[model samples]
Target: MTRLTATAENQSLCTLSRDGSACSTAKYHEGAIAALAQARRALTAAEPGADPDDPIRAVRARWVGQAGAGTTGAAWRAYLEGGRDGLDILLAPAGTSTGPAAGTPPSATGPTAAGERAPGPASRVLVGSAAAGRLGGGRWPRRRVTATAVLTPALFAVLVAAGGGFPAAAPWTVLVALVAVAAAATLATYLPGPGKGRRPALGCSPCAAMAAMTVLAAAWFLQAAPHQPSMAAAALAAVGFGLLQRLTQTDASCAS
Candidate 1:
């Protein structure tokens, strides 16, 4: 065994196999590829009937062409996703230091046997930092839709309870409808984003319209003291809005 002499320059020790076959370094790989490419180009430019024993021809046909074929998918995956405990640094070239590289945040995720670390608790949390703080690809959109859908009905329910103006004080139907609408809106989130080509099955328009008409009907009923042409007309504007949305939204649009 060779004792590694750690210097100010070389902060970490590296070990080599007895046969010196497993030299995993980005620079070495890059140099190998570049040399291979240059050699292949030279060989291709050579005369058609070159010597059969030409070293360049042998190298190209044997090593360069077969480099990736020998690498399994598992190896590629391991190489791409090195473990968090300075494993990638361990795999890097001799001259490169793995200590505190710029822009690469230190990993709190402990190393796994495999290079890829499993998702941590932070990744699993629904309202965690990443989910809430990410500019895109977060749970914010889902949360927003949920808050709006749920709050709209809740507010209307509160209004009805306070005034006793709208359709009798049975909150089950309205609450149930809101729950269903909220569920549909959530399902719609799994579909593609809005305004593309496909419209969502659970349209937010209907929910918004329902919430609005409920409030309006309650107020109208109170003002009329149970005397009105029809509460159905109270929903006409919402119905129109929903119809307009149906005309414009694509089938895949998750406008919940």
Candidate 2:
């Protein structure tokens, strides 16, 4: 079920465009909508009149109706221009007893007429809302940046020693230790955490630059440290961390 929802969301995101013209992307919206409708039906069948206000139904109806009415998707478009606040507006209408109202908190009603607990605003899921700004504009994770900085240099040093470029010496050991210390310092001082300093979210350009620098580092470790499983594991972990930096919003915005 989780897998199916992801597919539908991806389909909708792929079909979305600046204008609602009949482009290649627009063509896929029908499939996405159908998928959502199917899921909503299944859920409805499971509950069996538990509630008429299913969130999935609202999402499907709004997306399809908005498209047919030739209204540009203002809610989601606002999400692109604005972030989470826009998302709140986009999702506000779905499944509400009263009409759609931006930023209105969901009702605190304990149960529906059917005697089942009602789903709240938080339970609603809007397609394309989850991974917004991730394609090219999102900020990279700070922890990954720190790991790449430390390990890449260490990997290069290890490779040079293995290749007999120079005999492994105390000086090389000290250099690697120094690099680790620098990385730790950077992580502690600059990166955002529960109570750390606040910084505006940066775009992906810096991430790309850092990735290029560390790309060689991963290669070096793979080649020279095959016997040491831990080094290989760290290198792979760095790659995974780099890929997982998608953010829905910055900490500062979330904080405010």
Candidate 3:
């Protein structure tokens, strides 16, 4: 590689628009990446109310940073003056500086070579929600909703089955109700949309399930005769409800 002349380095390094007439530069920076960063900063400042922290902004920052490296003075100046579209004119030249030299491990490659990028907030929330449906769990939080939905119906069924089964209503009716409730809860889980933080009770499956179960248990207690066995059963149900509710409200998505 030919060393950049002192005159060439000075012209490339100087980003001030007020600098002398534009000219081609052989050397832009000691590191190619650094040169692009300086150029991008100047261009970003020209935008109205631009925020550096914006996710897409951050992505573009990294992209222009590396892609701009080793750029000729003429290309850098054009990009600064005309924005991203201006870079199109210099793609062929910039493409050469990207990626790793031959024989470099994939991990050792720079962002340009690897072609991987972190998602912005909007994108992260969207992708996390989509992934939650197919995969078990991750950054997405749905443990509370899932738990309440599962535990309530489950406990109700166990208690009913333990007490010689439902006498007043056909066993199939009880089973059908459980299935319907479960289906509703499942639909609600995906319907109200994905959440980033703590979720509410209205649309959450586990929360709704727990509420329904508690009501069903209380009704059972009311119908039973005032005997020790009946009271003991109600007490057990109450205790389970409390414990399950507490568990459901926690970050239990990972347990799945």
Candidate 3 global lDDT? 0.36
- Point out where model 3 deviates above 4 Å: 1-113, 137-159, 168-256
- Candidate 2 lDDT score at position 1: 19
Model 1 vs truth, CA RMSD: 23.5
Tens digits of lDDT, candidate 2, 1-256: 1221232342223334444432212222223323333334434454544433454455445444543344345333322222222223323454544321242122211111222232354443322332232322234466645654766566556544543444445554444444343333323223443332355233223442343334345446545654344554554454434333322122211110
Q: Candidate 3 versus the native: TM-score?
A: 0.20
User: How well is each residue in 1-256 modelled by candidate 1, as lDDT tens digits?
Assistant: 0101111111111222212323222212222222333343444555766642253444435433433655444322222232222223222333443342232222211122234433332222221223122212233355446654665556445434434435553443344344334333433343444322343233334442443344344445334432232432333333334333332332211121
TM-score of each: 0.21, 0.28, 0.20
lDDT of 3 by residue, 1-256 (tens): 0122232432222342323322222212122222223234443454655442343344345545644557545434433322222122123232244443332222222223233333442343343333322232222335536654665676556545544455534543444344334433333333222433333423224454554455455435533632234443454555445434433322221110
Model 2 residue 242 lDDT score: 39
lDDT of 1 at 127: 19
**How would you order the candidates by TM-score, starting with the best?**
2, 1, 3
Worst 10 residues of 1 by lDDT: 1-10
**Judged by TM-score relative to the true structure, which candidate is superior, 1 or 2?**
2
Report how far residue 133 has shifted in candidate 1, in Å: 28
lDDT of 3 at 124: 35
Candidate 2 positional error at 244, Å: 3.6
Q: Give the Å shift of residue 145 in candidate 2.
A: 25
